[model samples]
Target: MKKTNIFKIAFILTIGLASIFSSCKKDAGPAGPQGAQGAQGPQGLQGTPGPAGSTVLSGNGTPTSTTGANGDFYLDLTSSLFYGPKTAAGWGTGFAMKGANGAAGTNGNKIINGTTIPGATDGSIGDYYLNTTNYLLYGPKIASGWGVGTSLIGTANVKYSGWATSTDPINVGYGKTSIRSARINTTAITPAIINSGVVLVYARRNSDLILPGGTTPLPFSYDLSVVENIKATVNFSLGTSVIYINTTTSNNSLYAEATLEYRYVVIPGGVAIAAAKNINLNDLQAVEKYFNIEK
Candidate 1:
């Protein structure tokens, strides 16, 4: 019996130990499913700045405000810059110097005619002289002796101060007729006969004349002709000729008067006509003299 009780006690002890072990022991339950992720954090602050850097120099020398001349070239050391010459007032931006002027050249030789006259004085191309005997101006010396100088007479020599006119009444026939006439008397001037002479004549009708029966006057038609002679029938005298006006009309009853205006000039001898050039009327002095106008 005691043996049986001891076996029962042993069995009861075994049962208690088994109960305690079972209470202490545990089994991992499949890592208990993963947890959810967390939210993102705010950004970090910026870092502080480092020390300042050194300056880099440019150009030559330093920068300066120095006075310069007109054409001087220079550089500013302070600002490391280049410039032109400096004057007393301030620096200049233009050329610094000017060159000297050159010398005048020698004149060329004077020539006249084919002869190359001896004792010819030094003179310019257009130098001229009036010949006392012939009363002509000569010069503009060329290789050939004073080439044909200008004629001091005629249109070239004399000035036409004014004009003179004369009128004559006439009756016209069917054909052309010498209706009226006038003359340019060479004796009228201080010198009767000029070495070189020139004359100008102009003619026209004074007014229109009506025919006997017709109310309207026929158109006046006329022409002029100059002749050099001493005939009593001729109107002009003493070296000059007479200028005549001839008129004509289809109507026989036409009566008209003709008028004439004329001027002339006389030139003495000695001027080289061949070498002389024609004078233009535009020359103020010549024109004034020709018109007999004072300037």
Candidate 2:
């Protein structure tokens, strides 16, 4: 009687357990809340820039009678000007896109012009200094401390080229038609540039790069100088500037007969000596690079 009772009790217990499990139809309670996401990884290196598109035409010089569709455009690497929207006649006149001029960079209060030891708060890590006392420029305030200031005075002072002249000349002008000049776009000389303190620095191409008025280049050691050569003179008015090549030293020729091309640079404030010693002034490239200029 005891064995039978024990077996019956065990069977009843097992059946009760199975019924309890069966009553609960759910196998897993509604899925638990999703785990939090893991932290993201660091970013990869930046990619390089792409090349120019098909629509752009890169050439040695500016477009003249070169033909192009209405949508087509030309980039004169020599002239550094962008010309486009060509019609059936020829390439339309365009403005200068990039040149050796223009204030592509900005200098904050970092450049201390007066004579004084710049305070720590005067400028940040890369700020500059110029002690007028010594005309010593840009100590280049650094993390450790202000670096030894570089002297940009006397002979070391670089001349300025605030305004970049066109590779070509202003072909059309009214003044004394006797002067030889290049085809220069009026827009090349900005009003701000003309209005700024600047002086003239001209470059003469003895041989026309693209015109019939070219000749054997003269062997002149001083090709680029502030000194006036070839009876060259510039007349500035409003936004337009005209350079008159009155005569050529290489050959005694009349302006009407000679097809010459002139390229000039106008350094604002006459010479760059008056500019800050922090960086080279009048050079578009220097400004662009110093200020991290980009598209």
Candidate 3:
């Protein structure tokens, strides 16, 4: 009976050992293969800079253009721009001074500055000078007249005064006189200014300035008081006389005469042309020799 029991126990132990070996074999598994790589991710966004950065004009805050001279009305600034004529608001002020009469000042008059005395005629009439250094300067007077047509005619062989300089030197005639200093004489030869007449003034280039005309002939009367220089001519076409006036450049058509009236024509070289007195077209040849015409 002991031998039988030993054999049964040995059988049971072998069964348990075999079962444990079988379970260990079942727990073991096969190895897996390598997996494929994934696609690349999207790029990250850029970060902003810190504060205290420089500001620039980025938007369409376009600059405006200025017009002509009238467009000078705006100002430009570094950071921004603005227009001129700036207005101010909310204003206040406070200041005051008390007067006290002290010792009486010297019993005399205080000379104010730049005071021009009236009727200060010490300066010769027609003399041009600046009250101050910056003021305009001119020479003595050569003529004076009132109205638009008043004039001054120089004496033969003699130049007018007021300019202080001899006519022979300048060769240029005296211009219009300034009435501010000397008064005008509104006589028979009154200037046109009195009756819608145009006021003109000019200087002769040489003595030949007042020449006679080819057709019409008349007397030319001018002011003698204000002429600076002059030269007498031998033109006999001016049957009566010739006068050179200081007139404007545009008044060149003053040489006209009616029938039975003396005809005068202003010619080139400042010469006034006129016909001989009482000389008809038939007798023109006789007196023509006396007047000295090229024909």
Best prediction by TM-score:
1
Put down candidate 3 lDDT per residue, 1-295, tens digits, no spaces.
9999999999999999999999999998898887888899999998898654322221222234321122223333332343322224211121222345588875432212121211244344443333232121223333451101101222111111111111111122235321111111222222322233212111222233242322222223332223423222211111112222222211222221100121111212211212222123223232233233223
- The residue-by-residue lDDT of candidate 1 on 178-236, one tens digit each, is 33333344343443333343332222233322222221111223322222111111133
Clashes of 2: 12
Question: Top lDDT: which candidate number?
Answer: 2
Would you list the rank order by lDDT, best first?
2, 1, 3
Model 2, position 232: C-alpha lDDT score? 29
* Native-structure RMSD, model 1: 24.2
Q: Of the pair 1 and 2, which is ahead by lDDT?
A: 2
lDDT per residue for candidate 2 within 1-295, as digits (tens), equals 9999999999999999998898786564786899999999999999998864437677887676744555678888877778876667678687787656766676554555668645567667777876766565655678777644444544322223333334343344344323334334444355656666443333344444222233222111222123332332333233355433332232222332234333343444433433444444334334333333331
How many clashes in candidate 3? 52
Please identify model 1 stretches exceeding 4 Å from their true place: 1-102, 106-135, 139-161, 169-175, 183-235, 238-260, 266-295
Rate residue 17 of model 2 by lDDT.
93
